[model samples]
Target: MILANNLTKTYGNQIAVDQLNLDIPQGQFFGLIGPNGSGKTTSIHMLSTLLQATSGSITINGLDVTAHPQQVRRDIGLVFQESALDRMLSIEENLYFCAGLHGINKSAIKTRINSLLDLFELQSKKRASVGSLSGGMRRAVDIIRGVLHSPKVLFLDEPTVGLDLPSRRRIWRFIRNLIDDHKLTVVLTTHYLEEAAPCDNVAFIKLGKLVSEGSPEELIEQLGKTIVEVSGSNAEDYIKTLKLSAEDYMLDGRTLLIRVHKPQPNQVEQIQATLRDSADIISVRKSNLNDVFIWLSSKGQGTS
Candidate 1:
């Protein structure tokens, strides 16, 4: 449902996004993730028709984003970090106002609002003022408002930021349900890597360039199957002396993360026993996308 080829964005001599190439199919949940100032937002904005690209072309649902922006906008939904609803307005009122702005049929507005409110399990609270709802509910309402028009593509940029783990999980359940029911294609960007662990595909942005893109499973597998986390007060000293046959490793402050190439039985146990005296905390678990992210960032210019 989305296509971006060599999409470039710049400010004078500073390139914000460099030759980004993506092909996100319909109904796919795709993630654009990276450290701060890595152009994830810029890439999404260009895809959503909010910002124009400096070079190359983009198409959303086969509509040229630059040439047919108005039509493209009709097929896209965007929910950013900030709440789009008025704090004082009732949830029902807020959704109605947004639906009207989207030019949704007046005949279908109330039905749509009711259906979405029910789906998010906020029907009883629909009459309550938005300000009175919890943060999670408010974010849910934001997602509802974005989909009020039933846009084919949704752009979520840090939509769950600042929410606690439970709240984030709740919001994700809502999003996944929406995708399942409506086949809504999602383009999400968030600092919470675990939240994106279930994405159909993910693209990693680094230094405003595409460093890696693949399914989360593929990324984790490519990095390694086993990850060793070593922490101690004398972490620097431990890092200097540590020796292990591994694909790669990264040091984060006092935490040393090691990715073992192909873990063998009892490998973690032996490693832990070997480091028992030197480290304060040593543990091992299956590698995940977070490991891949840290590995990628370490190989690039330090993330901002």
Candidate 2:
């Protein structure tokens, strides 16, 4: 569990995070999303006790992060964006070393390592050097090392930022399974729209302020639109023709977004038939998380 009230962080004149309040319940997968340099990492650092909040309170499992930093560290496992693995060490060796650092007994360390190797499907690569592992394998090992002590909260900063599609999906599965099996509360910061869209809750950060927070569905329902965007050469003129009913339309540059008043029989056919007069319609697609982000960013005062 994590609770932060008006958490603020300042680096001289630049405010990295400001009055960010968040509550992540036990076993919940929470996502912190924002564009580049939007204070996501700064917020995570404060919540994980890596950085001190300038003017707010953070409590993890009933203990204040600033007052009991050591205890907070014990309760949280942090996996940063950059790989922190010892490339020279073997997969098992790295986990073993991390366990030992956490004061786990040698007997228990071996058992824990074995368990993680099995769970992460790294048993066959136990003896393989970290540098020799694939990107996904190395990332998996990094995560295992972070959770070696079975911390209650997991802080993952851009967990799947640079991985290929397969590797990213694999990590997503691993993260979801870990939370479900261990009942771990996760605080994740990522820019990937797909990644954040699946989280139990999402908090949007912009220029250090907490701009928006809600479940993906709640956000979509609140700010997103059922966008029917038709691409064609006459997008502008077609939009003007639809302008008499302008209250139901939105234009983002070249995209013509029309809100459906209600479902009509053969709606797709009618919409296309209307567009056939002026333009050769190319595509029509539904709205997604990116649309929600766009709407929130447009209304929020904070910078991306």
Candidate 3:
């Protein structure tokens, strides 16, 4: 239950977000993705009432964000890309400070903190200093701080940026459980495309504008059912022999990606056999979110 209409943000003569519009339904796992400086964060800041939009309208749960920022803040949680915890403080202490800021009752704060720590399996580390924890643990604590007050919507900006694969998966598991248990709406922005594949809907932004929006599966389907990638010094030359249309392929340096719609097992076999000698590497697999992102980014900026 969030709506933004004609949202715009500018810095002097340069525009950071331009006439952006979005309508996120309740309990939806929505994703906002773009390259660096594509205005994803600027849009999030304006929507969260941390920064004001130059000209636009935003409403959360029927209240205008700009007109009623205080009320809006109470309905949302934010976990920034960077850590927001006080490193010197114990994990429990950092959560306590956040709960107080959100005005949770003194009596209920301890119970809330303990429940969250248990959920993330951080109960034993509650007494540990934040700086002493591993990167993954600190990030988990940051999320615990954000949702301590149980806000209806959670905004996560690059929540899994630097974590290892296992840690990232663990964080997503926690987030998924939170959403399922509490009916929380999550709005996420991440550079890791594969991590976003589970989102109900995702929007791509470029040059401060909406480039494309759809379910991850729907977007990837636009690429094709299968992706064939060939890489080597001769890859580009070899791709020309396939006689594929320009729209069916993308070339990035030594690698060439070709979209094969509804390819049969035999078709894949034939393609691989043809490239066996000419290419150093050849792979044929199901298309994925990264393929969709690369194709979209390539079309927008003339590069991948």
Better of 1 and 2 by lDDT: 1
| CA lDDT scores, all candidates in order | 0.85, 0.80, 0.86
Lowest lDDT sum, 10 consecutive residues, model 3, at 295-304
Clashing pairs in 2: none
Q: What overall lDDT, based on C-alpha atoms, would model 2 receive against the true structure?
A: 0.80
lDDT of 2 by residue, 1-304 (tens): 8999999989999988988899889999999988788898888888888888889999999999999998788888989888888999998778878877778877877887887788768899999999999888888888888888989999999877668997788778877887899899998887788898888999888898878788988776655336567767767787666552544455676667664434446655666777876765535666677876765565464211
Clashing pairs in 1: none
Off by over 4 Å in 3: 261-282, 301-304
Across residues 1-304, which tens digit of lDDT does each residue of candidate 3 receive? 8899999999999999999999998899999998899999999999899999999999998899988998998999999878989999999888888878887866888887888788778999999999999988899899888888888899999998778998788789888987889889999999998878999999899989998888988777766778888898986677677766677788988988887764445766777888888889988889888888877777663221
Candidate 1: misplaced stretches above 4 Å? 127-132, 243-247, 262-277, 301-304
- Provide backbone clash counts, one per model: 0, 0, 0
Task: Give the CA lDDT, 0 to 100, for residue 129 in model 3.
Answer: 99
Q: Top model by TM-score, which number?
A: 3
Which TM-score value belongs to model 1?
A: 0.87
Ranking by lDDT: 3, 1, 2
lDDT of 3 at 137: 89
